[model samples]
Target chain A: MKFKTDRDAKLGYWLILPTVVAISTLIFYPVFYNLWLSMQEVNMNPIQPNTFVGLAHFIDILTDLDFWISFRTSLIFTITTVIGTTVLGLAVALLLNRDFPGRSVIRGVILLPYVTPVISAVFGWKYLFNPVFGQANYFLVDILHLFPQHINWIESPAFAIYAVIIFNIWRNFPFAFLMILAELQSISASLYEAAEVDGASAWQKFKHITLPELKFVLGALVILRTIWNFYKFSEVYLLSASVNVLPVYIYEKAFASYDFGQAAAISAILFIFVLGFIMFYVKKVLEW
Target chain B: MVGKNTILKNIIFVVLLIILLTFVLLPFVTMLSSSFKPDNEQNTFPPQIMPENPTMEHYKGVLNPDIFPFLIYFKNSLLVAFLSAGIGIVISIFGSYSFARLEYTGRAAIQRGVLLVYMFGGVLLVIPLFQLITKLGLFDTRTSLIVTYVVQTLPVSLYMLGNYFRTVPESIEEAAIIDGCSRLEVIYRIVIPLSAPAIVSVFIYAFMIAWNEYLFASVFINSSQLRTLPLGLNQLFYTQHYVWGRMMAASILTAIPVIILFLSIERFITGGLTFGGVKE
Candidate 1:
């Protein structure tokens, strides 16, 4: 018995080796390599090696006005979108948790925006908010007459963040909904039954029972959403150029300005900041 | 009075359901409606919700080889998605089974490492990865995308699959082991058969990740012939004289299959999804 168990342990190591190697090389190594590249002036030519700059890139990033603006923009975007998705998801999860005809089908359809490609979803958003001929302005100006005229809501810097936030919430709420619904299902029916026996109303049950049960999942959801939203790229980038977030800023620095070193430094800084946040959040909030 | 109150409550539920459906589905409706509109009507002021005269001209244009090369991009996407997801699934199956079933030295440590792995994001890796790819002379090739993509979903795949694999009765594997079956044989012959649905679901999720991937595809794949769908569609959007109708047509075609595949596996997906932090 002992010998067989030993063999099993050996087999386990062999089976697990590939993933260990892949994550270390593919994910962790790039992160470290990025940190190294950050301190050097990246040379694009084949002949010359990158020269060490010793925190020059970091100094530049600290002083650059646009970097501060993008950083502030990302924080606001993350906070608004995370709150939007969590609230909408909680509302929908509570509403839809009840059994109904065609419930399964509705649940599946609700996931479409999240599952659909970012490129596809954003294209829909752009067309809906298009400046010249868009359904959004058509409804707001031509039909409802809320605004005096058509507005370039997604394109203009003034309103693009709102549009992006709304878009983010629309796509991401499904993930939160799915997770929260699962947790809701697992809450014993006996608890609800006991509440009702005490003459608890719907609002009372939600406030006293449901909210407490949902606390953990909601916290995890918010943290996960914040992390994902902070570094969000494709949807925001593809939708509007004017709504500058850090990822878009990094892309421009690396590709547009051909400043690979600065871009690398910014990415490293962003990762460290977010990593620090995750540590504090996981330790203090989740208490795991 | 009781009956009247019940009726009012039911009406509110039905009305709210309808409103929620409309909000959730307006994008799909617009995508479908615009794709059918003729090019001239696509940009019309106070744009028609339903096309006045629907046509197949946009779809036909998308499929035409001379114009978009959409088919080539589609094929490239399919190939990369299948190849990477296939490889990722195979590695994840073994790794997840080990983590879930077998007790090994250092198992707890690696599990925590996998959790920390969730903190790393694409923007952090893009420059270094681009440098690594260029150094390897794999630029403009699918290999660059495939290798990175395989590992990109590893932690999620592990979390999701490990959760599912834990439910399979260990006694069966023990019995197989006693009957002189190797661990590898037991995994294939018994464990895999039981977890097929979950395996397939995780696979499709990873496939969608690769298919919808745009950042690396945009940077690494410079040759038009090698462009994946996201990059290609984006290029089409920027191409001078862009037609809204044709672009919407491409978007519709790009999204529908993935959504349908996801719907089919919705049950397995939501179950596993609760634990794994989402990729997006």
Candidate 2:
């Protein structure tokens, strides 16, 4: 309040006016509009208006097998990828915490997968998992004899979820890595030295110091990643047609099936769940 | 700091580093090598680590107007991303300055409200936005994408730039005010100049979000001629007899510009994006 003049208040409101306007129209309105749409049978005709259906779309979706499949898939993908990325990110962060030549360069390289566009990363993996030409099968089956045969990894319905999970891990772990590494570097070196003064083993020091220090960041990371992975679209959608996570399911329901009402229902369902998660997370992890 | 048995330990350390890096870099290597690989080499089993006979035909194939229409897609992506970044930054810069510098009623609540909206996934917004766009008759135009992308970017841009602005020493600003520089002029002349790295980072973040967007572009931009790069790449892949080489080449071209921009400001981005990470 240093600038307590009325002019300062005026300026602040004026400054945020455009932002408030934009978000209200573009984000806030759409979120509530989606709820309304979920309750309506939207008409395709330009002249004819949408009609109220009063929970019919939700009932229809809840009864459908496909919606259940997507719900299950979203849960599996979110949990597995959240755990996978956190573990991988923690490992890399710990590894890179120690100094070596070209450390910064390696750190930058690790971030490439996360920072690059999803389309490119998916294309790269598509080549890796290509049935005939992919190097993944060639290396695993032919070179190392890890698998009995080349599996149709991305294309097959049975294994495509795993491919999506693996790709999600590959693309997202670096995000966790970047955050954890920042936290890891911030840990006081003096504390580690104090532990070492008592002749503590590496495992004891890590268990006593590192894990405890990482608990909050890891908790927040898991929450954020869960929310994100639950709503993940482009990664799974681009990876394969076989994998139908919730967001992809919504996209198909709306655009592919031309049933915007059902799609809105799915979105409404997802929004409520996410809102509940965020509220709980803010209260618990964020302590807001 | 070298101790006894240092040789074995160093070897193990180097080996571990290599193994970790291999996991990260192999996909990129595969993409780059495959891009250079001719069709015969690309389709060969036990995919080549390095193309023996590198060729530009794949790049040419993707660039061909009839085959991929690279220019139109490229132009669409460039325009959308550029405008999104431009407008988002301009709008956010002012809002963020107020957040960092000024105190006003309801500011904290509004800030939290924005972050809350940030967590709402694009999937939630896509349906209603599509409906609105169609109703407004703005569907299938770059204008629809430009405005949507700008709004999509606002929250993150504000958060990042606001964080950056808060760190500018108050004493410097106070001196400027005492010397009679108006608040807006101080922002224009001093704040903007001092925060170059952060501005670049925010701009790049907004640009890349727009650049890599797929969900909205897929639904909103229905016409083939109006498609952005992600849509174009998706179109290229979903068609019959899609060539691996050409797809990889196009992927490389699409990603290279963003990677270069980001790497140039890697240090600045770490502070902004990872303060509490937000992803596109």
Candidate 3:
């Protein structure tokens, strides 16, 4: 039944042709097309004359104070949040990795943050972090009596980023947990058995064997999460419209200011930053 | 043998589990309890984890036509999610099979290329995709979202299906071919049957991604009637501002289907995650 001639190769090409065409048309064309758009100034408003301004938008975006503020915010937000989620996720995964009481129910509950709609959580978080009547502050001031007056969680930029970070970590750690838990399960019981026979303590086995085995997954997840988190838009913006992150910054430029050119430029820059890691990840980590 | 260190280690694990479990459940408990309470009671001091007078009034409001186009939103979301899942799974099966099994020159190149396509962020394509859809007279059409969702969901589908297909022994396909099955027949009769679990897992995963998607649906589809649940819910939030009861009711309804499905298929989903993880 084997095709033993040149026709087989030809047939293979013919078979694959449609998929390649679809991929090119639906995927690659838009990517290359956006890259082109980023280069030229395309006025979103029909009234304004669309002009080609070379690299001006990128220059302007790079120099803009608001843009830099957001870039810094994104950096801090991405780093701290990712570290928080990964550490928390690993800890939980380790705890749940063993046979414990109520394990099945606890596992299901762990997925809540990942399962809940972003908008729902964002809204709930906003209400919880409300300066005046928010529940978190109420619990803090009224019950715990930690803070006397209200704390504006979403108003001040300093506190706003932290609130959003908390929300992000909460929503995302489950994803990390899922992956880490899967990895934890796969580690051979024999390795721990052998380690114990060799007089290795639990901490020593985890530190030497478990952590080392998890390195690639941890590296891959952190990279992927960082890229996703840095470009994370909806949660932060939805929580407070004023928080300036890269995605929101793009939204403002594209939608609010109606400056499609600048927005496209910023998008291109962010894509490059995000895509750099993606390419590395796909090439080295994912290894298709 | 029973040392202080062993006791200390056990205590640490207990403490960590307690904190983690609390973090996981508290917000949701708060949300669920608050949903049943009256509007004024949503922000009560000390935060009622258990409603004083638990009632279904908020649920009624959420289902009210004036509050939300609940039925319409539900129907639209169902249609969108089902359509995308169906379309995404079919296209990816073929595409991923070709990448996994069929041998030809440039196979590696194409695989890498598809993986690269996976990394391309949605934000970058938003403008052009909108323009293309508009030019195709699909602006504000469900078709626009459906077609665009394929682009978003395709990569993960391909990766999942491709990896699954690879794990399937080629000898089975060869034997099927020898039994006079055509290429198409071999796939339909053998491969598809063998990969049902993977296919189901991919469908559910892709559906969730499409189902929970908000930003694109919000941006691309403008008509309230055409809005998906996420968009519909957001619109409700915007208008009502802080009506916690109604919001939670809608949120709970929006989340119920997937949650129920996940709970039912918890074994399959976790199994898939484990499978995908090992390969990775």
TM-score of chain B of each: 0.95, 0.94, 0.92
By DockQ thresholds, what CAPRI class is model 1?
medium
Decide which is better by lDDT, 2 or 3.
2
Poorest 10 consecutive residues by lDDT, candidate 3 chain A: A1-10
Q: Worst lDDT window (10 residues) for model 3 chain B?
A: B271-280
Interface RMSD of each: 1.8, 1.4, 3.1
Candidate 1 CA-lDDT value: 0.88
- Estimate how well candidate 3 is docked, as a DockQ score: 0.45
Residue pairs clashing, model 1? none
Candidate 1 lDDT, A1-288, residue by residue in tens = 323488779988999999999998888888889999999999975236999998999999999999999999999999999998999889899889888899989988898889999999989989988878888888889999998878998779988987898888999988888889998999999999999999999999999999999999899898889899988998788888788999999998998887999999999889888989888998998898
lDDT of 3 by residue, B101-155 (tens): 7777797898788777645666676765655566678878898888777667777
List residue ranges in candidate 1 displaced over 4 A. A1-4, B272-277
- lDDT per residue as tens, model 2, B97-196: 9888877898898898788775788888999999898889998999999999999888888988898898888788888988999889889988999998
> For candidate 2, lDDT tens digit of each residue in A1-288?
465677888898999989999999999999889999899998765246989999999999999998999899998999899999999999988888887889889888999998899999999999898888788888878999987878899889888999899999999999889889888888999999999999999999999999999888888888889888888999998989789889999998888877888899999998888779878887987786
Residue clash pairs of candidate 3: none
Docking class of predicted structure 2: medium
